[model samples]
Target: MAGRILVLNTGSSSIKYELVDVTTRDRPARGLVERIGEDMGRLTHRAGDGPPYTRERPVPGHGEGLEAMMEAFAAAGPELAPVAVGHRVVHGGTRFTEPVLVDDEVIAAIEELAPLAPLHNPVNLTGIEVARKAFPGVPQVAVFDTAFHRTLPPEAYTYAVPREWGVRRFGFHGTSCAYVSRRAAALLGRDLAELNLIVLHLGNGASATAIAGGRSIDTSMGMTPLEGLVMGTRSGDVDPALAGYLARVDGLDAQQVEHALTHRGGLLALTGTRDMREVRARDDDTACLALDIYTRRIRKYVGAYYALLGRVGAIVFTGGVGEHDAATRAASLARLERLGITVDPALNQMDTTGERAISPSSAEVPVLVIPTDEEWEIARQTHALIS
Candidate 1:
């Protein structure tokens, strides 16, 4: 707890690392290794407040990505000797409800959940294995992205599908949602227990969750990340029969359809691009349609969860697009005036840098934009484990 905590958020093709001073709640250094397992990989490292250090080289795998991160810290400032290494493991299933120290058995459990999250869990375990070897005896903690939603009630999580499939809604982005929703309560000067919040996590992967009395009552993403709002590359929802129809008509297998839904679908499929900023910058018809699809999906969830909550204290927005894109926020909440949700145009349009309420003064439900700090949350949880 006295030393820095190294928080690692490893994706299939990237590694995001931060050296956080737990006591001060400050990040001394942070960097990203992007496009791993490909040619022309890039590493951008930043320390303190200086310019970022950049490198372009081939990163053959996640192991190399970790090595590059270490090299970045060594070459830059702030020697990296972490008290603990916190990894952001995607699918913890029902086994891990909170951050737990990783052991061989835990690693095996994560591997067992791979079928539930084919693209994420396997790669996540790879990061865990490589880090365990690289950092030797350091305490390694698995801070799950799904951990925060473990409080979800049975009715909310159970899917309508046959129970034999052993599938249920295991919400993603729990770390970001947990961090932002708690911060939302703090920002509003209210106790989280008394607050009913609808948290919208919009990024490459998006989800909406209803936090009733500070526990996840319901969420948009179910069973898999592919079940929620439109995402960057994943199709959020589709007709149940579409997969079988594609198999019969187009000679596509179940795996092929799943791959497209997981990889080539969503905003990328609707439009040529997936990033909201890119879509917003374009004035073409396709871009406009994609934006409509994205925001409409968000609006539906807001309305659905609002009904479920009966009384909403706040509608919180976080993640890449939610935190930065004001236009999307305004557009998504525009028609909810009857629900007491209205954003002040001037406040919403302002170039704000931190958390702030954008809802109109007379609005009943406060609409807030909170920047998410998953790395800080991971570091805090890891520190807690050791303490």
Candidate 2:
């Protein structure tokens, strides 16, 4: 239990694995198997401060991806023995509110939930299966992204749709929110239970969550990840009649429309590039408009969540765009001075790789930039379950 936990986050085309020392809170080894099932695949492994050991080969399947991971561990150092294996299972639905030890029953339950997360759960299960095979006796724990938002109130998670449809808000990024919210409380020198927070997780996949007294009261994502803030490739929110309209005008099916929204929308649809930094670098009108649309959507959500929380102690930003893009940090919250959320321009632009406040010390709501540590959270949960 004191040794290490191997955390696996299996995506459709990538497998991210990390060897974490739970006691030290350090990652001894971490790497990714990217472009699985593609002709050109890459694996990059890093241990300590040295340059990453990388390999390029065709990884035809997740099994091959796991094999490449083992090769990387064996070829690189650290000896690759973990006390427990932690898997990042994206959707837990209503059944799982906390991390659980993986068993045949757990595996079957996860399989049953696959339709809710068609793109994620199967690959996640593939990772679990491979990990079970790779480390036969090691205890495997499933850490759910939806688990942290299980505290969402009935009004926040409930949808107006038919109850028979079984559709409701299932906020994503709970792991990141959990890590950053606790850090935000520490940074503010306040107990989390007393703070009302609006957490914006702005990575490739983004979400805005309102937390009160250390619990999720409301969130942006509803039913699926596509309902949230504008993301790298996924459109945040569309009119409820969009699918029917598309069908009438362009002869598209609901699934096809959903696929397009998930894959070809957001920044990519607006600017032809999914990377925010790339979009920010361009001076073209198209890029400018895309940025406006993106930030406007975010501002709208911030205002909506503000109304929900009534009083926000801090507006915490995490994930890639939230952590690194100072311009975005400034633009997203611009003109909110009436709400006492003012960014200190100099402080916001200052380059630092740690959690720090970007808003003026006297501001009503401290705007913080907290880099999320989801992998470590997964390892911690896994260790807790096995220990």
Against the true structure, what is each candidate's TM-score? 0.97, 0.96
List, in order, the clash count of every candidate structure: 1, 0
Task: Give per-residue CA lDDT, model 1, range 172-201, as digits (tens).
Answer: 898898899889999999999999999999
Residue 154 alpha-carbon offset, candidate 2, angstroms: 0.8
lDDT of 2 by residue, 114-145 (tens): 87777788989999999999999999999999
User: Whose TM-score is greatest here?
Assistant: 1
Instruction: Give candidate 2 misplaced runs (Cα > 4 Å).
Output: 35-39
- Model 1 spans with C-alpha error above 4 angstroms: none
Please report how far candidate 2 places residue 217 from its true position, in Å. Answer: 0.6
Query: Model 2 lDDT vs. the true structure?
Result: 0.91
Indicate the worst ten consecutive residues by lDDT in candidate 1.
73-82
